[model samples]
Target: MRPLRNIFAAILLLSGAALWATARADDGAGRTPTPHPPRAQGEHCVADTDFMRRNHMKMMMAHRQDVLHEGVRTPQFNISGCVNCHAVKGDDGKPVSFASPQHFCRSCHTYAAVKIDCFECHNSRPETDGKAAATEIDGEDAARLAAFLRETKQ
Candidate 1:
Protein backbone atom coordinates (compact mmCIF):
# COMPACT_ATOMS: atom_id res chain seq x y z
CA MET A 1 0.00 0.00 0.00
CA ARG A 2 2.89 2.39 0.89
CA PRO A 3 4.65 1.65 -2.42
CA LEU A 4 1.41 2.29 -4.40
CA ARG A 5 0.94 5.66 -2.62
CA ASN A 6 4.52 6.73 -3.52
CA ILE A 7 4.02 5.78 -7.20
CA PHE A 8 0.73 7.73 -7.39
CA ALA A 9 2.37 10.86 -5.86
CA ALA A 10 5.28 10.64 -8.34
CA ILE A 11 2.88 10.32 -11.29
CA LEU A 12 0.89 13.36 -10.13
CA LEU A 13 4.08 15.47 -9.76
CA LEU A 14 5.27 14.49 -13.25
CA SER A 15 1.92 15.34 -14.79
CA GLY A 16 1.91 18.74 -13.07
CA ALA A 17 5.42 19.49 -14.33
CA ALA A 18 4.45 18.49 -17.87
CA LEU A 19 1.47 20.87 -17.81
CA TRP A 20 3.64 23.72 -16.54
CA ALA A 21 6.21 23.16 -19.24
CA THR A 22 3.52 23.11 -21.97
CA ALA A 23 2.01 26.36 -20.69
CA ARG A 24 5.42 28.05 -20.66
CA ALA A 25 6.22 26.77 -24.16
CA ASP A 26 2.95 28.13 -25.47
CA ASP A 27 3.62 31.54 -23.85
CA GLY A 28 7.26 31.61 -25.07
CA ALA A 29 9.49 34.38 -23.56
CA GLY A 30 6.74 36.28 -21.70
CA ARG A 31 6.29 38.79 -24.58
CA THR A 32 3.41 37.35 -26.51
CA PRO A 33 2.42 39.47 -29.52
CA THR A 34 -1.01 41.08 -29.49
CA PRO A 35 -3.26 40.33 -32.46
CA HIS A 36 -4.82 43.26 -34.28
CA PRO A 37 -8.51 43.43 -34.92
CA PRO A 38 -9.98 43.18 -38.40
CA ARG A 39 -10.41 46.45 -40.30
CA ALA A 40 -13.79 48.06 -40.80
CA GLN A 41 -15.50 46.85 -43.96
CA GLY A 42 -16.69 48.96 -46.93
CA GLU A 43 -15.89 52.66 -47.47
CA HIS A 44 -14.36 54.53 -44.49
CA CYS A 45 -16.85 57.39 -44.20
CA VAL A 46 -19.77 55.45 -45.64
CA ALA A 47 -20.31 53.47 -42.43
CA ASP A 48 -19.62 56.40 -40.09
CA THR A 49 -23.13 57.78 -40.18
CA ASP A 50 -23.56 57.69 -36.42
CA PHE A 51 -20.18 59.35 -35.92
CA MET A 52 -21.05 62.00 -38.52
CA ARG A 53 -24.43 62.58 -36.93
CA ARG A 54 -22.91 62.95 -33.46
CA ASN A 55 -20.08 65.17 -34.65
CA HIS A 56 -22.34 67.17 -37.00
CA MET A 57 -19.98 66.42 -39.84
CA LYS A 58 -21.32 66.44 -43.39
CA MET A 59 -21.75 63.05 -45.01
CA MET A 60 -20.39 62.34 -48.50
CA MET A 61 -23.17 61.45 -50.93
CA ALA A 62 -21.64 61.29 -54.41
CA HIS A 63 -21.94 58.14 -56.44
CA ARG A 64 -19.15 56.74 -58.63
CA GLN A 65 -20.73 58.15 -61.81
CA ASP A 66 -21.32 61.55 -60.25
CA VAL A 67 -17.70 61.74 -59.08
CA LEU A 68 -16.42 60.70 -62.52
CA HIS A 69 -18.71 63.14 -64.31
CA GLU A 70 -17.53 65.89 -61.97
CA GLY A 71 -13.87 64.97 -62.63
CA VAL A 72 -13.24 64.04 -59.01
CA ARG A 73 -11.60 60.75 -58.11
CA THR A 74 -12.45 59.35 -54.68
CA PRO A 75 -9.49 58.75 -52.45
CA GLN A 76 -8.42 55.11 -52.34
CA PHE A 77 -7.55 55.07 -48.62
CA ASN A 78 -8.46 57.73 -46.07
CA ILE A 79 -8.60 57.32 -42.28
CA SER A 80 -10.46 60.48 -41.44
CA GLY A 81 -13.39 61.45 -43.65
CA CYS A 82 -12.65 64.47 -45.89
CA VAL A 83 -9.04 64.36 -44.65
CA ASN A 84 -7.99 67.04 -47.16
CA CYS A 85 -9.84 69.59 -45.07
CA HIS A 86 -9.31 68.12 -41.60
CA ALA A 87 -5.54 67.61 -41.95
CA VAL A 88 -3.22 70.60 -41.64
CA LYS A 89 -0.04 70.80 -43.70
CA GLY A 90 3.35 72.21 -42.67
CA ASP A 91 6.03 74.13 -44.54
CA ASP A 92 7.60 70.78 -45.46
CA GLY A 93 4.37 69.87 -47.32
CA LYS A 94 3.69 67.05 -44.89
CA PRO A 95 0.36 66.34 -43.28
CA VAL A 96 -0.35 67.60 -39.69
CA SER A 97 2.26 69.28 -37.53
CA PHE A 98 1.71 67.18 -34.40
CA ALA A 99 0.00 63.96 -33.45
CA SER A 100 -2.98 64.41 -31.14
CA PRO A 101 -5.30 62.14 -29.18
CA GLN A 102 -7.86 62.80 -31.90
CA HIS A 103 -5.36 61.39 -34.41
CA PHE A 104 -3.97 58.66 -32.14
CA CYS A 105 -6.77 56.18 -32.66
CA ARG A 106 -4.73 53.45 -31.02
CA SER A 107 -4.66 55.22 -27.66
CA CYS A 108 -8.35 55.07 -26.86
CA HIS A 109 -8.69 51.69 -28.55
CA THR A 110 -5.87 50.35 -26.41
CA TYR A 111 -7.62 51.57 -23.27
CA ALA A 112 -10.80 49.89 -24.43
CA ALA A 113 -8.83 46.75 -25.30
CA VAL A 114 -9.55 47.07 -29.03
CA LYS A 115 -6.51 46.68 -31.27
CA ILE A 116 -6.15 48.70 -34.51
CA ASP A 117 -3.45 48.62 -37.23
CA CYS A 118 -4.25 51.56 -39.52
CA PHE A 119 -0.76 53.08 -39.25
CA GLU A 120 0.88 49.87 -40.46
CA CYS A 121 -0.45 50.08 -44.03
CA HIS A 122 -1.79 53.65 -44.37
CA ASN A 123 -0.05 57.04 -44.28
CA SER A 124 -1.26 59.73 -41.89
CA ARG A 125 -1.97 62.04 -44.82
CA PRO A 126 -4.62 61.43 -47.44
CA GLU A 127 -3.83 60.85 -51.13
CA THR A 128 -5.21 63.59 -53.38
CA ASP A 129 -3.89 63.79 -56.97
CA GLY A 130 -2.59 61.00 -59.14
CA LYS A 131 0.30 61.03 -61.64
CA ALA A 132 -1.93 60.59 -64.70
CA ALA A 133 -5.32 62.18 -65.32
CA ALA A 134 -8.11 59.66 -65.78
CA THR A 135 -10.70 61.82 -67.54
CA GLU A 136 -11.58 65.43 -68.33
CA ILE A 137 -15.02 66.93 -67.77
CA ASP A 138 -16.46 70.40 -68.28
CA GLY A 139 -17.16 73.16 -65.64
CA GLU A 140 -15.42 73.81 -62.29
CA ASP A 141 -14.16 70.49 -60.94
CA ALA A 142 -14.17 71.51 -57.28
CA ALA A 143 -17.72 72.87 -57.44
CA ARG A 144 -18.92 69.76 -59.28
CA LEU A 145 -17.17 67.57 -56.75
CA ALA A 146 -18.81 69.39 -53.83
CA ALA A 147 -22.22 69.12 -55.46
CA PHE A 148 -21.69 65.43 -56.12
CA LEU A 149 -20.71 64.86 -52.47
CA ARG A 150 -23.79 66.74 -51.30
CA GLU A 151 -26.07 64.31 -53.12
CA THR A 152 -24.73 60.89 -52.10
CA LYS A 153 -25.26 58.63 -49.03
CA GLN A 154 -23.58 55.57 -47.50
Candidate 2:
Protein backbone atom coordinates (compact mmCIF):
# COMPACT_ATOMS: atom_id res chain seq x y z
CA MET A 1 0.00 0.00 0.00
CA ARG A 2 2.92 2.41 0.77
CA PRO A 3 4.55 1.56 -2.60
CA LEU A 4 1.26 2.20 -4.42
CA ARG A 5 0.91 5.59 -2.66
CA ASN A 6 4.46 6.55 -3.67
CA ILE A 7 3.76 5.62 -7.29
CA PHE A 8 0.62 7.77 -7.37
CA ALA A 9 2.53 10.72 -5.89
CA ALA A 10 5.28 10.34 -8.51
CA ILE A 11 2.70 10.24 -11.32
CA LEU A 12 1.10 13.45 -10.09
CA LEU A 13 4.48 15.17 -9.76
CA LEU A 14 5.55 14.13 -13.26
CA SER A 15 2.25 15.22 -14.76
CA GLY A 16 2.50 18.66 -13.09
CA ALA A 17 6.05 19.11 -14.39
CA ALA A 18 4.96 18.17 -17.91
CA LEU A 19 2.06 20.61 -17.77
CA TRP A 20 4.33 23.42 -16.53
CA ALA A 21 6.83 22.81 -19.33
CA THR A 22 4.06 22.78 -21.94
CA ALA A 23 2.59 26.04 -20.60
CA ARG A 24 6.01 27.75 -20.50
CA ALA A 25 6.71 26.66 -24.08
CA ASP A 26 3.28 27.91 -25.22
CA ASP A 27 3.74 31.28 -23.48
CA GLY A 28 7.05 31.99 -25.20
CA ALA A 29 6.22 30.46 -28.61
CA GLY A 30 4.90 33.53 -30.43
CA ARG A 31 6.60 36.78 -31.47
CA THR A 32 5.08 39.90 -29.92
CA PRO A 33 2.94 41.93 -32.34
CA THR A 34 4.19 45.42 -33.10
CA PRO A 35 2.06 48.25 -34.40
CA HIS A 36 2.86 49.73 -37.78
CA PRO A 37 0.62 52.77 -37.98
CA PRO A 38 -0.19 54.16 -41.41
CA ARG A 39 2.16 56.76 -42.82
CA ALA A 40 1.08 60.40 -42.54
CA GLN A 41 0.03 62.40 -45.59
CA GLY A 42 2.40 65.16 -44.58
CA GLU A 43 6.16 64.90 -44.68
CA HIS A 44 6.61 65.30 -40.90
CA CYS A 45 4.64 64.82 -37.72
CA VAL A 46 4.07 67.62 -35.18
CA ALA A 47 6.73 65.87 -33.11
CA ASP A 48 9.26 63.14 -33.76
CA THR A 49 8.16 59.50 -33.69
CA ASP A 50 9.80 58.61 -30.37
CA PHE A 51 8.46 61.69 -28.59
CA MET A 52 4.95 61.16 -29.96
CA ARG A 53 4.97 57.52 -28.96
CA ARG A 54 5.91 58.34 -25.40
CA ASN A 55 3.94 61.58 -24.82
CA HIS A 56 1.02 61.84 -27.21
CA MET A 57 -1.59 60.95 -24.59
CA LYS A 58 -0.28 63.56 -22.20
CA MET A 59 -0.16 66.24 -24.87
CA MET A 60 -3.62 65.38 -26.20
CA MET A 61 -5.22 65.46 -22.77
CA ALA A 62 -3.68 68.86 -22.11
CA HIS A 63 -4.86 70.06 -25.49
CA ARG A 64 -8.38 68.82 -24.72
CA GLN A 65 -8.45 70.74 -21.47
CA ASP A 66 -7.24 73.86 -23.23
CA VAL A 67 -9.90 73.57 -25.90
CA LEU A 68 -12.82 72.64 -23.68
CA HIS A 69 -12.09 74.74 -20.63
CA GLU A 70 -10.01 77.66 -21.81
CA GLY A 71 -11.39 78.19 -25.32
CA VAL A 72 -7.87 77.81 -26.68
CA ARG A 73 -7.25 75.77 -29.78
CA THR A 74 -3.87 75.35 -31.36
CA PRO A 75 -2.86 73.62 -34.58
CA GLN A 76 -0.13 71.77 -32.75
CA PHE A 77 -1.26 68.70 -30.83
CA ASN A 78 -4.73 68.99 -32.29
CA ILE A 79 -6.57 65.69 -32.67
CA SER A 80 -8.34 66.89 -35.83
CA GLY A 81 -4.95 67.42 -37.35
CA CYS A 82 -3.99 63.87 -36.39
CA VAL A 83 -7.12 62.43 -38.00
CA ASN A 84 -6.57 64.45 -41.12
CA CYS A 85 -2.92 63.61 -41.53
CA HIS A 86 -2.96 59.98 -40.40
CA ALA A 87 -6.19 58.97 -42.09
CA VAL A 88 -5.97 55.42 -43.39
CA LYS A 89 -7.86 54.99 -46.60
CA GLY A 90 -10.09 52.01 -47.28
CA ASP A 91 -10.39 50.22 -50.62
CA ASP A 92 -13.04 52.75 -51.59
CA GLY A 93 -10.52 55.62 -51.13
CA LYS A 94 -12.49 56.97 -48.16
CA PRO A 95 -10.89 57.22 -44.73
CA VAL A 96 -11.50 54.14 -42.62
CA SER A 97 -13.48 54.55 -39.39
CA PHE A 98 -12.26 53.34 -35.96
CA ALA A 99 -14.29 50.13 -36.47
CA SER A 100 -11.66 49.04 -39.02
CA PRO A 101 -8.46 47.49 -37.71
CA GLN A 102 -6.51 49.55 -40.26
CA HIS A 103 -7.59 52.81 -38.64
CA PHE A 104 -4.50 54.76 -37.53
CA CYS A 105 -5.36 55.02 -33.81
CA ARG A 106 -6.37 51.35 -33.62
CA SER A 107 -3.03 50.18 -34.95
CA CYS A 108 -1.32 51.05 -31.66
CA HIS A 109 -4.27 51.07 -29.22
CA THR A 110 -5.38 47.56 -30.21
CA TYR A 111 -1.84 46.22 -29.99
CA ALA A 112 -1.57 47.64 -26.45
CA ALA A 113 -5.04 46.41 -25.38
CA VAL A 114 -5.94 49.99 -24.45
CA LYS A 115 -9.51 51.19 -24.56
CA ILE A 116 -9.88 54.81 -25.78
CA ASP A 117 -13.06 56.86 -25.46
CA CYS A 118 -11.72 59.74 -27.55
CA PHE A 119 -13.41 58.44 -30.70
CA GLU A 120 -16.74 58.15 -28.88
CA CYS A 121 -16.92 61.96 -28.85
CA HIS A 122 -14.69 62.72 -31.84
CA ASN A 123 -14.75 61.37 -35.37
CA SER A 124 -12.27 58.63 -36.14
CA ARG A 125 -12.06 59.49 -39.84
CA PRO A 126 -10.99 62.75 -41.39
CA GLU A 127 -13.55 65.51 -41.56
CA THR A 128 -15.05 66.07 -45.02
CA ASP A 129 -15.89 69.77 -44.60
CA GLY A 130 -12.90 70.63 -42.43
CA LYS A 131 -15.20 70.79 -39.41
CA ALA A 132 -15.52 68.51 -36.43
CA ALA A 133 -18.53 66.26 -36.76
CA ALA A 134 -21.05 66.50 -33.98
CA THR A 135 -23.01 63.42 -33.00
CA GLU A 136 -25.98 63.93 -30.71
CA ILE A 137 -27.07 61.01 -28.57
CA ASP A 138 -30.74 60.88 -27.62
CA GLY A 139 -31.77 60.26 -23.99
CA GLU A 140 -32.22 56.46 -24.24
CA ASP A 141 -29.11 56.00 -26.34
CA ALA A 142 -27.08 58.24 -24.04
CA ALA A 143 -28.18 56.21 -21.02
CA ARG A 144 -27.28 52.97 -22.77
CA LEU A 145 -23.88 54.34 -23.79
CA ALA A 146 -23.25 55.51 -20.23
CA ALA A 147 -24.11 52.05 -18.90
CA PHE A 148 -21.86 50.40 -21.45
CA LEU A 149 -18.97 52.66 -20.51
CA ARG A 150 -19.57 51.89 -16.80
CA GLU A 151 -19.48 48.16 -17.50
CA THR A 152 -16.31 48.44 -19.55
CA LYS A 153 -14.61 50.48 -16.77
CA GLN A 154 -14.72 47.38 -14.56
Q: What does candidate 1's lDDT look like per residue over 37-72, in tens digits?
A: 233323554446457434422223343344547766
- Model 2: per-residue lDDT, tens digit, 32-87? 56788878999999999999999999999999999999999898988888998999
Model 1, global lDDT = 0.44
Off by over 4 Å in 2: 1-32, 129-154
In lDDT terms, which candidate is top?
2
Model 1, runs deviating above 4 Å? 1-44, 51-94, 97-100, 104-113, 131-154
Give the per-residue Cα lDDT of candidate 1 at 142. Answer: 39
**Lowest lDDT block of 10, candidate 2:** 132-141
| Angstrom error at residue 20, model 2 | 19
Q: What is the model-wide C-alpha lDDT for candidate 2? A: 0.80
In TM-score terms, candidate 2 sits at: 0.66
